[model samples]
Target: MSYIPPHKRQLKDPVSPSPFPDSLATKVMKNTDFKSSSVKVNIAYSRDAIFKWFLIGSKGISDEVPPSIKLVPVSSDSSDSRYGEKSFVLMNTNVEKENVIAEESEEEERTRWMLIAEKVEKDLVVAYEQAKKGMQDHHLSDNAKLRLVARFGKILFRRIHAGPVTEYWQAKSSNRTFCTDVPTSFIQNIKSKAIPSHEFCIDLEKEVYVVQISHYTRPHSTIICKCTVKEDGSLSMYKAELNPLRHLVVDVSCIDKNLDMRFMLAGKRKMFTLTEKERSNIQRMLDSVTVDSTVKGGLTWPHGKPPSENGYTIFEVCHVRATTYKNKTLRLRVRETNGYSERFGTWEVERGVTLILQDINTKLQEQNIERGCVLEMLRDALGTIWDFLHCDASLT
Candidate 1:
């Protein structure tokens, strides 16, 4: 998973009255004013499903992502018996491999971004504890501290999803642990370096520099983001993805079991929709698995939006040309719709998705094509995790 924090982007200051006359990607419907001091921003969450809309699925089934927190059209006052049934439909798309791969990579980035969950949680905890003592015994002042509590609370709640989480794994000689806070700045330093949370703006004319600061925390675990403040008072949002080879620790035991095709199928009994040809491909793929042999193949996966010139726009996958069975080769992009490329509707493209297919397309043109042993293992892990999330009995 990558670091994908959604924020409103603008090209000028106080964008309430800015004329949004049918841009390429964004469709401005209701008129709203953008205030410098405060602006109302609503978006359908990419993850942490709440209310009616959850994020899209890997297979792009009934994955119609809608605006987050906004009320659905079906109200209790409706006369129809089928109340609360969603009226949404899948976003239209075209047929193309490049576009799908683009969106897939972005989604893949989100999956990898969660690897920083533990670290981010800890950092937030430290921020909270520090904020706690800042109180001067006043009742109202203490309530102000409560605001800081939301930050810490949201971090942990979002990470485990307010659900049961197996947080740590430890053995006699080796152990792994996660925390909500790791001491960074003392109370004194924090006060001085505190950058007040500002509504970030995106400036088109200025240089927008994306910095990936790895050394600020754990060499591979921590990531720091910096972007230019635009004239419209929006700062560019970041979709920081994790590089498995460089960032993730390899689990030998899990790796062994995942690579074993039989082991992967041991508990999975739940049904999945697959064409006969797709089924045949899966079976043939499993039969052909070999140690040290890499298969460079991309899954003919589906995304929510239809494919277009710039891929399917939002929730799309691309550049899925090739990947190592052992190494990751996916690229996901999260951008605004009104920017250079577009996916659909008249809304700012808050975030984007990209999927990775571990097939080395380049190798298809060559004589010798090696398969990636690790990707085989990864596909199983991803499936198992996803199945668990979707409440599939097989994963249990």
Candidate 2:
């Protein structure tokens, strides 16, 4: 009768099998309206095992890997570097000016940050230790939640945290990592597709849609995945198929207090909802200044009022634009936008949209498009995203 089972039986180690009346597999059949009862009993305990074995403190959890991996949302913490690395450059500039007064060259200060990679390595080593504590302690592997944490770890591991590890982990790009032991049999039916890096983590509270398409190597064909988190804590996968002929386009938007901003196509995922404080900070950002989508997708946008005089204001911070595909493998992109399509004051955004439209149509005219080749492209995108942002830790 109770949604949760009695705690007495499961209290042995707080992670032992619960004396529940209905197993998760049984409940899943009942809840999903499936007719089969011949399901795994471990489903009921998979979430628990993940929590106890991989998510809590390291004191009372097993270090061994569990059968099921949970995906928990690692919400952005109250703490994040405000200015990112750009702030350091500005500080160095000021310091260099003072150093010049005292007798140091600007080049010296510029080169000073080159060593930051070494320090970041120290931080990464420390972070990995701290990150594993939650997993080693709790064993919570839902796969439908806590994805951000896993990816945060990846970004740290591959990029900012320590620069780059030895080729034992990866080669060439900071976005790639090679795992030698994974067997294809365990992950059968998995195929490659392309998806957009835009609108990543969209509607995190309700869904996790990504775009996908069949894989193509020559940079003409790309695909993406679109996944949603179901009410039962399961994931529904989707994909975005690229029209190599259709020319997938991406546009990043942000403002510059310094006016000198640069961002590579580092990586992206579907945009999810933020915590209360993040929402607040985002609101403040919307109020204070104007942020523009550098890519001319020709978006009409509505600007919000500044918090300088008025109270807090709400704003639309996400958007989507998936391409129509002839294949089942989809090319999806969930772009995070600050109401670019609605914020245009008097400037016409159609011009920008036309540009992208032209690119797609132009490619089509060039006869450079193909279909049903998403496996490799999708694999690469998945690999890129997974290596850069995914970890078995999403099983939180």
lDDT tens digits, residues 1-396, model 2? Answer: 111111111101000111111112233222332112221111111221111001111111212222221111112331112111110011011323333333534334223322222222232223223333333465522211211111111111122333212221122222211111111221111112222232222222222333222212223222333444345432244432222110011111001011010111111222232246644443333333332346332121244332221322222122233322222222222222122212222111110000011122222222223322322332333333322221121221
Candidates in order, TM-scores: namely 0.18, 0.21
Please report, as a residue range, the 10-residue window in candidate 2 with the lowest summed lDDT: 252-261
Report the lDDT of model 2 for residue 149: 12
CA shift at 328, candidate 2, in angstroms? 28
So what's the TM-score on candidate 2?
A: 0.21
**Alpha carbon lDDT at 82, candidate 2:** 19
Per-candidate Cα lDDT values, in order, are 0.21, 0.22
Error of 1 at 243 (Å): 28
